[model samples]
Target: MSEQSPLDLAEGDPFGPHNLPYGVFSTPDAPEHRRVGVRIGDHVLDAGAAAHALGSPYAALLARPTLNPLLAAGRTAWRDVRRALTAWVTVPAHRPDIEPLLHPLDTVTLHLPYEVSDYVDFYASEHHATNVGRIFRPDGDALTPNWKHLPIGYHGRSGTIVVSGTDVARPQGQRKAPTDPAPVFGPSVKLDIEAEVGFVVGTPSALGSPVDLASFEDHVFGLFLLNDWSARDIQAWEYVPLGPFLGKSFATSVSAWVTPLEALTAARVAPPERDFPLLPYLDDADAEVPGGFDIRIAVALNGQVVAEPPFAGMYWTAAQQLAHMTVNGASLRTGDVYGSGTVSGPERDQRGSFLELTWNGTEPMELPTGKRTFLEDGDVVTMTAWAPGPDGVRVGLGEVTGRIVES
Candidate 1:
C-alpha cells in the first residue's frame, strides 16, 4: 500500500487550505537563499517554487526572498494570488508538482517576513486603557479626554521588530520610584508583555492623501500576533510628558506567519459602541462591513495559560486605526505595521499585559512555576490566537513567543 500524502491533512487543521498564511523561510541545505513560503499542515510550501512549477503568473512576486513584492501588488493581486495558492494545494491534479516543493516546517528557518517600514502601536482597548489608568491614577478618570474621540497611537521603532523565538534582551534604562529623589539606571526590574494583533500594510498611499475608513482593505495585506515587550519601570519614569520610547523600542516580537486579511471574513464583528460622537473622518457607523475582529488571544507564561484577551471587545478597530493613522496625510508604505494595543476584556482574566494582570505588581499571580508579577530574566511568554472562520472552522493566527534574557 502507498503511504498517505502529507498534503492530506486531518479534518479541521487550522493551517489548512482556508488559512494558508505566508512567511519567509530557508532550508538547512540553502540557508542563505530565503524564499516566500506558505503554511499547510506541518509543512512549508516554497511558494515561489510552486508558482514556477505550476506556471503561475505570480511567480515573480512569490519568487522574492521577502513578502514586500506581493504586499506591494495591492488588494486585487493579493486576492488573485491567494485564490491561486488555495487551488494549488487543494486541487488534486496539481498535487504531483506541488508535493515536491513542500518542506517539513521543523526543517526550515522562519525569518521576519517583511522589512518593516514604520511601526505604530495604538491604545485601542478601552478595558486595557481603563485598567492602566485606574492603576496609575487612582484619583483621576480612567481614560484620557481624547481616548474616545480618536485612536491614540505613537510612532515606534521598526528596526527592533523581531520574528518569534528571538530572545529579548532586558533593556537598560533610567527608572525612578515615587520615593526616589533621583532616577537610577539599570536593567528593567519590571519587564512586561503587551499582547497585540498587528496589521501589515500592503499597497502604499500617496503622500499628503488621507486614507479613509472604507479604504482600509485596499491597502492592508494581513494580520499577525505581536508581543510588544515593555519595560514598565522605564516607561513609568519616561512616559509622562511624551510617550513610550526606550521602554517599548528595545524589541517587539511578531509571529513568523502573516494570516491574510481575506481569510478573516467570518471574524468581522461590530466594535464596542462609541460613547462620544466620532468625527466624520473617524466614523464607521455605516461601514459596509464591521471593523472589529473576533480573534481570541491567549497569553501564556512559561507554557501556562494566564489570560485570554478577546479582540472583539476592543473599542477601536483596525479600520479606524488605519483611517486615523493616515488621516494626517502621512502616507502608508507597503510594509508599514500598526498594532492593536494590548487587547483586554472587561474581565480580569482577559487582561493582556503583565502590568494589568498583576495590577502593577501589587498582585502576584500564582503559577505552577512560582509567584510572578513581572517577567524574570528567563521567563518565556508566548501568545497565540484564533478567529472564527467559514463553516465554523477556526483560523489560527499563529504564535509570537520570546524569552527574556539578561541585559
Candidate 2:
C-alpha cells in the first residue's frame, strides 16, 4: 500500500479542505521568521510558500507575517483567495508542489494573527443580560428599558489582547463590600470568564460613511472564539456611570485560527425574535441573509465542562451590531475586532459566565476539582466551539485558553 498523504484528510475532519482557517506561525528552526499558514487537518500549510510554488497571483497577499494585508484587500479578493486555496488543496494536480510546503501542526508555534486596530465588545445576549440584571437588581426588571433598541457596547483596550495559551496575571484593583465603609485595594477575588464569539473586520470604511446592515459581509473577514476575562469585583465597583474599565482592560484572549466567514454559510440562522420594533438602521426584518449563527460554544474550567452557551440564541446579530457601531460614522479599519458578549441560553447550564452560573457567588458549583465560585490562581479556562458547515460537516473554531497566575 502507498503512504497516505497529509492532504488526504479523513472524512468529516473539521479542518478539512472545506474549512481552511488561517493563522501565523513560526518553526523552531527559524523562530523569528513568522509566515501566514492555513490549517488543514493535522498539518499547517505554509500559505505563502505554497502560493509561490503554485505560481498563484495571491502570493503577494499570502507572503506576509500578518493577516492585515490580506484583510485590507476587501471582500472580492477574500473570496478569490479562498477559492484558490480550496482548489490548491482539493485539486490533485497541485498536490505535488503543495505537499512539500506542509508542516506538522505540533512543530510550529502560533502567534497573534493580526495587529488589532481597535476592540469593541457588545452586550448582545438577552438571557445573559437578564441574568446579570436579576442578580444585581433583584427587585427591578431584568431587561433594561433600552436593551431592545440597540446593541450596547464599550470600547476595550486593544493592547491587552493575546493569543491562545498566554498566561494572564490576576489584576489588582479597588473593590468594596456593603459592610465596608470604603473601597479596598487587592487582587481580584472574583475572577471570571465570558465566553464570546468575535468578528474580525477586513475592509476599511470611510470616517463619515455609515456601514449599513447589508454591508456586514463586505467588511468582516472571519470569526473566532474569544475569552473576555473579567474581574467581577473590580467591575462592580468601577462600572457605575461608565461601562467596564480596569476589570476588563487587563487581558483578553483569542483563538489563533480565524475561520473565514464564507465557510459558515450553513450556520446562518434567524436570531431570536425581537420583542420591540427596531430603528430603521438596526432593523433586519427584510434582510436577505439571516443574521444569527448556529455556533455552539463549550466553556471549560480546569479541564472540566461547565457551560455550553448557544450563539444562535443571541438577541442581536453581528450585522445589527456593525450597523449600530458605524451609525455614528466611526471609521472601520482592517484588524478591528468586535465580540458578541457572553452567549448564554435560557437554561442554567447554558450560562456563559461564572457570575450567572454561580449567581454572583450566592451558590457554589460542585466540580471534581472541588467546589468553586470564581477562578483561582493556577486555574485554566478554555473555550472551544463548532458551527454547522456545508454537506453536514462541521467547521471548528480554534480553541482559546488561558491560565490564571498570581498578580
Candidate 3:
C-alpha cells in the first residue's frame, strides 16, 4: 500500500497501483506461444522466472510451462503467487537481487490470461439493463418482470476469447430484409463492442453439488477486461427464440492479465440495494456487505475516448450469478470464465456499447477525425479500468486492444 516503494509508480497506473493483476506472456521476441507474467511499473515480471527465484511452493506453480497447469492448482496456490508478487515488486531499489526477474512491458507478448474451460456472462449492471430494456420494451418500464429476482446470464463461447492485439474478423450471418418478411445472408453491418469485466473461476464443484452464494468468492480467482463483440443485425434475426448464437459466438477479446482478488481486496464495494428481496438461498447470511467490485471502466475507439463508467452501476453481482448458476447443482471448474454484461451508466453519453452509444446506430458517434457510426476496418478499440484507494489506484484489470479486420 505504500506509495514510496522505490519503484517508479505512475499517477494512475493500475498494474502497480496496489492491485497486482496476473497475466501470461513470453518476451515479445522469445516465441509465438505465451508464458505467464505479472505487471509492475511498465514492466512484466516473468512469473516462472520470478517464482524460480523465490523457490518453494511459489516456484512450483510458476515454474510450470504454462498458466493452465498452475491455474488448476486452485486458490491456495493462487494466493501464494499474489503474496510473493506483492513482496517482490515492493522491494527497495537498493536490493540488487530482484532486478533479474522483472522485464520491460514493451518486450512481452501478452497472451490469453488463462485457459478458459467455459464462459458465462452476467447482466449485472442495472443502468445497462434498464437502458436496454427501455430500447426494447419502451412503455416506460425499464426493468423486466424477472429482472429483480435473479442475475440473468448466458453461456458464452470460450473458444473465441482472444487476448489484446488480435485482429477481429467481421462476422457474417443472417439478417432480415426491411422490405421482405424473410432473411438474407451477408457480412454484419452493425458490429459492436460491449465493455465488460470477466472473472476467472479457480476451483471446481461436482456436477450435482451446488455452491452457496456466501461461498462463491472462494470459487473465483481473479478478474480481467472483456469485450463481447456483437453483430447487431445477426443478433436481431437469431436472438428472438434462443438468445445470441453465431452473432456473438464468432469472437470475444479479453486482456491477458488476470488481476487476482487478493490485490483487489482494498477495492470491494457493496452491491446495489434490491428492489425486491432475494431468495433465502441467494442471500448472504454473513451480511457484512452486499456484493460488487468497484473498478472504473472506460472504452476508446482508435485513440478517441468513448465512454467512462463505473462497475458500481451494475444491478446484480458476480457472487449472485455464480450462486444462481449452481442452483440446479451444475458443476463449475477451474479456468471457467464469467463476464459482467456490458457495463453502462445511467446517463446517455455513458452508455457502454455502440448500440446504446449511437442510439441503436441511429445517431453516429462523431470522432475528432470525422469518422462515425460502428467500427471500421483498421480502427482500434481499447478498454482500461482501475479502482481508487488509499493504498494507490487498485487496478481491477488490464485491457484489450483490437483493430477491425475485413471479412
Candidate 4:
C-alpha cells in the first residue's frame, strides 16, 4: 500500500507504514536530556541534528535549547515541519535542504510531546459508551440525557501524563464492597488500559470566543496515541454525581510524536453516520465518507498484539469534539490536549479496554502463552497508530507504552 517504498513492513516496524511523526528522546546513557527525532521504519531520524541541515522553522526550534518553542509555534509551524520532513525522508533527490541531521533511532529519550496545561478526556466512542452504560444502567438507555446532544468530557490531571517507556503505578481510592455499605480506600486491583487518541491544541482561543465547526480545523495542530489507564474499582466508588477524579487523574500516557493534520490528508474519510443530526455549529459543510482519517490502530501486550482496530471505528469525529469543547466559550491554550475516549467496535475482541474486552474480568483473555484479567507487573501495554497512503503508509503517531509497576 505504500506508494513510496515497496518494502515489506514487519507489523512491528514503526516507520514502515510511512509515518514520520516527531518526538524528543535521549538514550539510557543520556537519560537526563531529550532530543527531537522522527520514526522511520524501526529507526529514529534525529530532528535536532537534522534541523541544522534543513532551513525550516523546526531547525530554528531545534536550534533552541527546549521544545517549548516548537510546541508554542502552533499548527502552521507543525504543518511546515511535517511537509518538509516528508519530502526530505521520502524523496531526497531534489531537496538538498536536509541531509546532515539524520541519525540512528536508538540514541534518544522520548519525552511528552508538549507541556500540557490541562487534559480533557471525552466519551467519543458509541460502542464503548453503550457498553459502559449497560453496566451502569441496564434498561438500554445507556446514554445520559445530554450525551447525544453534545460532547461530554471530564478534565484530568496534566502532571500525570507520561510518555512511553514510563512505568504506571497502581492507583488506590475508595470503593464500596459487594456486602459493605461503607467505602474503603486501597490499592486498585482492577487496573486497566484505555486505547485512545489525543489531539494537541496548537493555537490558543480567547476566552468567551465560540469555536465553530467550520473553523475547528485551524485550532487542531495534530494527533497522537493515548492510553488512559483506569482504576475501575476506584472509579466505581468515586464516580457518583460527578465524574472520574482520583481514578483518572493519577496517570495518562501519550505518544511522544504529534502527527500534523495535513499528513493524514489522503487517509481522511467520512465518519460513521451520526445517531442524530448535529446542531448548526457542529456541521461540516464539505466532508467525505472518510473525511476524518482511516488510521489503523491497535494495542499490544508485551510484544503480542491484543486488540487490532481502526481509527474509523470512532463514532464522533475529532472536529465535532473540538467544536463542542469551545461552543461554551471555553478558552483553549497551546499544548492543551483532548482525548478521544476508548475506541471500541461492535465485535467483542475489538473492544479497546480490558474491562470491556474481558467482560469486566468476568472472562479473562487467553493469550498465546496464557491468560490475563488485567495488566500484571512488568506487563507493557502499547498503543500504535498509522494510515495507509499512496506512497508507503504515512506513519504519524507512535506507540504509547508503559509497564505496570508494583504498588
Candidate 5:
C-alpha cells in the first residue's frame, strides 16, 4: 500500500493503488458460485485466487462466497488481508502470476458483499431535517427541541435490503392524501430517493457494553453508497406516531464494492459546528478521524445530475452515531449497516431528496425525462461519490443505481 501500483492506472481512476475496495463477484462461466474480489480500475482481482497464490493466512477467509468471514475476523486481520492484496497488485514481481486471475468488471456479476444483519437510518443532516420539518410541520418549529442533542435514528429491516442493479418494485401501501377523508390502498405515487452514505460493521461488540467514540474505526469495516428509497406519501400517512414502516422498509439498494475507510484518510474533516452542547456520551473527543468524512456525493435521476449533497454537512458524525446507538446496551453485529440519512446542504442545489428539491411536489425539476415532482415508474436513480486520496488523488466510491419497475 505504500508504493503506487506499477499496473496501468489512469487519471481520476477511483480504484488506484490507494483505494482497493472489496466485494463479491461471479463470472458467467461460474454463475452459480461467487467469491471475494478486490476492485482495481476496470478489473477485479479475485481475492480468493490471489490469497491462495500468496499463501496468505487469510486465504481460507478470503475464499468465502461472501465477505462475512473476513468481517468476522477482527480489525487486524482486515488490515493484514488488505496489505497482502495491495502488495500483490502493486509489486511488479507478482504481476506475472496475478494478471491471469484478474477479471474484467463487465464480464462478471456482483452480489451483496455481506449478509445484512441489522440496518439503522439516521437523520444526521441538518439541512435535510429542517426541510422535512418545514414541509410536514409547517406551523411548528423546523427542528424539534432535542434535534441538536443527539443523532436521531430508527431501526430498518435488513431482509429487504438489495444490492445495486436490482430493480426496485414500487411498493403498494395505504396512503391518505391531505384532502382525502379516508386513506386509499394503492401503489405509491411519491416514491423518492435519499442520497446517503453507509457504514458497514465488521467487528462485533458485547450485549451490555457500549462502543465508545474512539473505537468507531475498530468496529467499522468500510463505507459504501446507499440509496434509502422512500414512499414519501406512505411515510407521510403512517409516520405520525411511531415512524416509517412500509414506506421506508420496502427496498434499499447498496453498492457492491465497499472502500476501506483507511483509503479515505485524507477526506476526513470536522463536522459542522453544533448549536447545543452535547451530552458526555455523545461528545466528540480524541479520535482518529475527529468529525466525519468529506466524501463528495451526487444524485442522478434518469442520467441527469440534479444534486451534490454534501456528506460533511451532517450535524452528527458517523463516529457519534455508533456511540449513540450502543450507549443503550445494544450489541453490534456483523453486517450491521448505519445509514447517514439524506445529506442535504444549506444551498438549494445541494438538497438530497426530491421532496426538498421540488418543495413537496410544488416545484418540478425539468429534466430530459420530463418535469419530475417525484419518481415515475421508469425513473432510475444513481448515486456516485469521491473521497480525497493520498498524494492529492481522488478515490472513487462504488455507485448504487436502481431502476423502478411496477410491483
Candidate 6:
C-alpha cells in the first residue's frame, strides 16, 4: 500500500495518489502536441509540464509526449519521479508550482500511453483455457498435455493495437466451412473480446539473456486494461497449422492509463500450484510476492455488467509468463506489451468472453438489451478493474473500451 495524496479524490475514484496512473493526453486547444500526465480524481497532472517546470530530468524525457523516457529510466528513476510528484502535490511549498500543470480529465484527449514495439498474448487462465478447449473440441482433453508445464503465448500484431474508444471494424478474412472444399473470403461473423491485463516492459534486455521471475518489477512499468479482439470464425479455419494472424490482429484496444506496478502491493496473491514436476526456470512461483493480483474485473455490454472475470483465477502468474518469454533469449524493448489472455474463473458468470459464457453460441446470455451469444453491430464492450488499495480502499486501473462496427 502507498501513501495517500492530499488531493481530494472523487467518490469511488480509483485514481488516487497511490494509483496515479500515467498516460498521454492532448486538448483541442493544444492539439498539435501531446503531453504525458497522471490521473488523479477528475484532473490530470501534466507530469511532463510539471517536470519541465521543476527543472527535473523527467521534464526532458516527458517532453517527447510518450512514457518511453520514464520507462527507460529504470527502477531508481521511476521511484524518484513518483516521490517528486507526490511531494509536488502533498508538500505545501511545492504545491503552487505543480498546481498550474493540472488539467481537467474530461477536457483532454487521451492517447496510447507508449509506443508498443512488440505485443504478446498469453493464455494463463486455467478456467478460460479449459472452457475454450471443451467447447471447441468436446471430444478432446480440456487442456493440452503441456499446458500445466508452460505458459502458451503468441506474438500479436503491435501495429493494430489501438487505444480505448477506437472503433473496431468487423474483420474480413478467409474462412472455409467445415464441409466446404473451398476457402471463402468475407467479413468475420464471430467477433469476441478477451478481457485481459497487459504488462508493459519499461527496460530493454539483451538479445540472448532471460529475465527471471524476481526481476519482473525491475523491468516492467505497470499494468493496463486490454481487449484482444478475436474473430473466432476466421481463427477456427486458419489455426490448424499456424497460430492466429488476421483473426486476432484487426484491432486490440488498451486503456488510456497505465497503473504503476508499485501501487498493486495489496493486490498481490499467490498463483495456483503447478501439477507438474519441478522445472528449473518456473520454480516456486507461489513463494514470496507471487505475480497473481486480486483484481476484480467486470465485462459490460451496453453499460450492463455481463461477467466478472477474476484476475486471481489465472493459472500461470505474470512473473512466470515474463520468465518464459525471455527464457528463450527474446530481447525486450521499452514499449513491449504482454497480456494475460481471457481471465476467467470456475463459475459461468466469471467467464471472460461470450464464447465461453454462451458455450460457443449454443446458449445465449440474457441481457437487458436482449439475448446475446456474441456482439452485434453498435454493441459496446467495456472492461474495467480495481485492485485492493491502501486502507482497504480500491485502486482503479481505468478501462479498455470499444464498439463493434460494420465491415
Q: What is the lDDT for 5 in model 5?
A: 38
TM-score of 6: 0.96
The lDDT of each candidate is 0.95, 0.95, 0.78, 0.75, 0.91, 0.88
Q: How do the residues 193-219 of candidate 6 rate in per-residue lDDT, one tens digit apiece? A: 899999999989999999988888989
Error of 2 at 85 (Å): 0.6
RMSD to truth, every model = 0.6, 0.7, 3.1, 4.0, 2.7, 3.1
| TM-score (all chains, Cα) for each model | 0.99, 0.99, 0.92, 0.89, 0.97, 0.96
RMSD of 2: 0.7
Inter-residue clash pairs, candidate 5: 14-396
Better of 3 and 4 by TM-score: 3
Kindly report which residue pairs in candidate 2 clash with one another: none
The worst-scoring run of ten residues by lDDT in candidate 2 lies at 362-371
lDDT of 4 by residue, 1-407 (tens): 63433223365454642467667766676576566766666566667666666555567675543455766776677767776766767674623444334445555566775778778899888889888888667776988877777778889998999887789988877877568879887788889999988888777889999876666567777788899999898888878879898888889998877776766777777777777777887766455334467877888888888887667867777888888888889998887888999988888867889988788888888998788887777888988877756555455467788988887
Tens-digit per-residue lDDT, 1-407, candidate 3: 84343256757665663776777777656676566777787777777766676564667667654566766777777777676777777766423555676777787777776778998888888888877777767887888788788888899899998888899999998998457688889899888999998888888889998888777667888788889998988988888777888889988898878777776666778777667877987775355655787888889998888898788767777788888989999899888989988999888767889888887777788878884778777779999888765555556467788888999
> Worst 10-residue stretch by lDDT in candidate 3?
2-11
2 against 4, candidate with superior TM-score: 2
In model 2, what is the error at residue 174, expressed in angstroms?
Answer: 0.7
Off by over 4 Å in 5: 1-6, 285-288
Among all windows of 10 consecutive residues in model 6, the one with the lowest summed lDDT is 3-12
Count of steric clashes across candidates, in order: 0, 0, 9, 29, 1, 0
Report how far off residue 132 is in candidate 4 (Å).
0.9
Q: Give the candidates in order of TM-score, highest first.
A: 1, 2, 5, 6, 3, 4
Model 2 C-alpha lDDT per residue in residues 126-199, reported as the tens digit of each score: 99999999998999999889999999999999999999999999999999976889999999999999999999
